[model samples]
Target: MTPSVQSVETEDEYIHVRFRDPDEFDTIRTPDWAAHAAQDVSEGSEVRTGKQKDSDDWEVQSVLIKKQVGEDKARDEAKQIVEKIES
Candidate 1:
């Protein structure tokens, strides 16, 4: 099953992926995926399941980084909403 990554933690020699599924996780030694997951986790992004390498192995296919809106942009949006409501 493709599980959403709930958390990523660094260990002595591995990166642990805690899945949203209860008690489901994987210790990864693959450097590429590990690094990607680490960055995504730090950025509060979503890590998507790529493919299953085998019965016991899976790969990270993509990282979905959440875009942070600027404070000015948010304020502008709020102003627009207020104007719309007043109209």
Candidate 2:
């Protein structure tokens, strides 16, 4: 399934690319699509997936370290990571 990008924002020194996955429960048992994408990603990119303590939905976030590869590159790589999440 193709995940959708719910929003994008910058926090601290990282550009956060956020996506959502429906959770029937509070459990997040989906594949670590972000991690797998990170392996082939660049610019010190990283991803996190979890169900927030106060929310019943699961969120997938890809962060691009702005200090590492610059904002432009980081943004490109960040989106790429999200694209390659399951492709």
Candidate 3:
């Protein structure tokens, strides 16, 4: 499952990201661009999926920003996309 971003805090040269669901956090040493981008992301706004590098450490592979939409609207859009793909 993808972990939802709960909060982000900067410390030294790393950014600490707290996550929901798994109830854990990871420290990321991101490039300057990514660090700046992280600051603008609101809590609960993005979902992160990654591979574990070691115990208590994760390497973020992708970050997905959540779009503002009603649940029903998102479901309808997903259905439409799936239908198009299947046709």
**C-alpha TM-score for every candidate:** 0.27, 0.51, 0.25
> In model 2, which residue pairs have backbone atoms overlapping below 3 Å?
none
lDDT per residue for candidate 2 within 1-87, as digits (tens), equals: 546666566777777665653342354443555565675877455676566667765555435445546556666676677667545
Q: Residue 77 of candidate 1: its Cα lDDT?
A: 31
Error of 2 at 11 (Å): 0.9
Candidate 1 lDDT over 1-87, as tens digits, reads 343445544433333344433323344333444434445233333344433434564444333333353333323332332223223
Over all chains combined, what TM-score does candidate 1 have? 0.27
Best by lDDT: 2
Which has the greatest TM-score? 2
Alpha-carbon error at 85 in model 1, in Å?
A: 47
Tell me the lDDT of candidate 1. 0.38
Summarize candidate 3's per-residue lDDT along 5-71 as a digit string, tens digits: 4554443432334443233334433344433343353222232433344465443433332344433
Residue pairs in collision within model 1: none
Determine which window of 10 residues in candidate 2 has minimal summed lDDT. 21-30
State the displacement of the C-alpha of residue 87, model 2, in Å, after optimal TM-score superposition.
Answer: 3.5
**Poorly placed runs, candidate 3 (over 4 Å):** 1-66
